[model samples]
Target: MDHATPRVKATLSDEGQRLFDLFRRPQGRSRPRPGERAAMEGARWGRLTVGDTAVVTYRWGDGARPVLLVHGWESRASRYAKVVTRLLELGYSPLAFDAPGHGESAGDSTTLIEYRDAIVQLHEAHGPFEAVVAHSFGVTASFLALRDGVRARRVVAISSVPDFGYVVDAFCARTGLTPRLRDELRHRIERNLYPGEADLWTRFSVLTGAADPRPPLLLVHDEDDEVVGPEQARRIAAAYGERARTLTTRRFGHRRILGSPPLVAAVGDFVSTGAVSGGLPGAEAAR
Candidate 1:
């Protein structure tokens, strides 16, 4: 009887579409191919341990107050070359690292907890930081790291999310894991696969401690971002309110948001001063 009856699966079908949307990044037809190769050749690359895991590091610029850029998931630090160059031009030393499992770093899967820990290690290694900039998952990890104990003058969350639950839900959506199976899978991933403890989301509440952290934050996201959505930035802005500053752009989308000049200027100004000074408040386009 059950086999003969057509079951309603619109819920699952919707889930599939959501998954597709979540993974749909911006179409960057003209990204930095030449710049990437040049940066790779021009900059000195090396490895360092952020605790047990080895992270790949890129060095550029020269100043006392270091500006660190942590890349998003599945991306190496080298990809943020444009931002690094801008930071250098702003007169601050720049350091970026490939988090574990990405770029020249060691490991397989990554978790927010591990990412935060890596940032902590990196901060300790080469900081007394003037500022830290991060994108996507790196943004979440940055929040948690700051809340832990890192002391930076300011933060720039490029395409950041405030909630860890959303991050988990995003993963489950992509993997098509039911609540029960998702729980089971999360348990397994945390226990054996990940470099950190189980239940990272729960740990976030305590780890990312802030009753409004002191440093001014610059949050950048795109309205058309199909990956993490602009709502994530809204949530963080709401949490910090005036303490939080934001820039939204059209067409920049997930990754290419870096390519926008206004975005670069915003970051540069933020590094120069705690505020997102110069040009305009919001919306940037790539050239």
Candidate 2:
């Protein structure tokens, strides 16, 4: 609970001009934790310009068969070091980036539209991708980009956020915003975040769309996830039906699941061969 929440709740009805600013901005950027520095070694680092913002990018191994790795909110590309290592071993190039306001990127705040635009630009440079691997909020951006015509042979969504409303609801719950303030925040996000998109809520959702023969999607989630919850994966699995394969794990929760050795290998296998090599421990597959 940073100082923003209480202050916003206190002054929201008065000097509430920047009420949604904290919502748009991540509270803090993530860094490579100890023993995580090696995960980023031997990568070609560069920057992609999206609407005048410099987004730091990473590419591992030869740029042959490219797979996009999208990290969640308050996370960075280095978070995928283990997966990157596995992908390289499996002969798939892993491409990742620090979304505008996260990691070593240039911005104080960012939006789903910004994330989608960055993905589209990356696709223009290194797509149609072999596969897409995303976590949490990144899953939302990936879905929006796919809806907007980004192509990939397969997708891996870990602890996915199913829609924009879930994001808002979760934030309000965590920040303890008043009901009145929460409703106002939602309206402000709709009107100001990406203006003129009246259908932003429906269009950005994974639950409302049609079954249009999307790429084979692999959905991984923790049964005990404390951040995004297991229902998000269930909803996506139900919506995608036969097109989506789900794997449920325990103990790893939300973030640690990213670096789980078994999970990383599963992702690599799914990306390269379109299947998991060995059945994961405590894994449950949903139809």
lDDT top scorer: 2
Clashing pairs in model 2, backbone N/Cα/C closer than 3 A = none
**Clash numbers, per candidate:** 0, 0
> How high is each candidate's TM-score?
0.79, 0.92
Candidate 1 per-residue lDDT, tens place, 1-287, comes to 67544443555455545543443322122233566766656566767765578777777765467887888876767777777778777778888877766776776545666678777876877877899888887887887788778878888888776666676678788777777555654454455444455556665532244455568788888898988888877777776767778777778888878757768888888778666543564564221
The reply for model 1, stretches above 4 Å from the true place, is: 1-32, 193-199, 205-208, 277-287
lDDT of 2 by residue, 192-287 (tens): 888988688898886666478789989999998999989889888988988888888888999999998667877977887777644666665554
Q: How big is the positional error of residue 93 in model 1, measured in Å on the Cα after superposition?
A: 0.7
Query: How displaced is residue 158 in candidate 1, in Å?
Result: 0.8
What lDDT is reached at residue 78 by model 1?
A: 71
TM-score of 1: 0.79
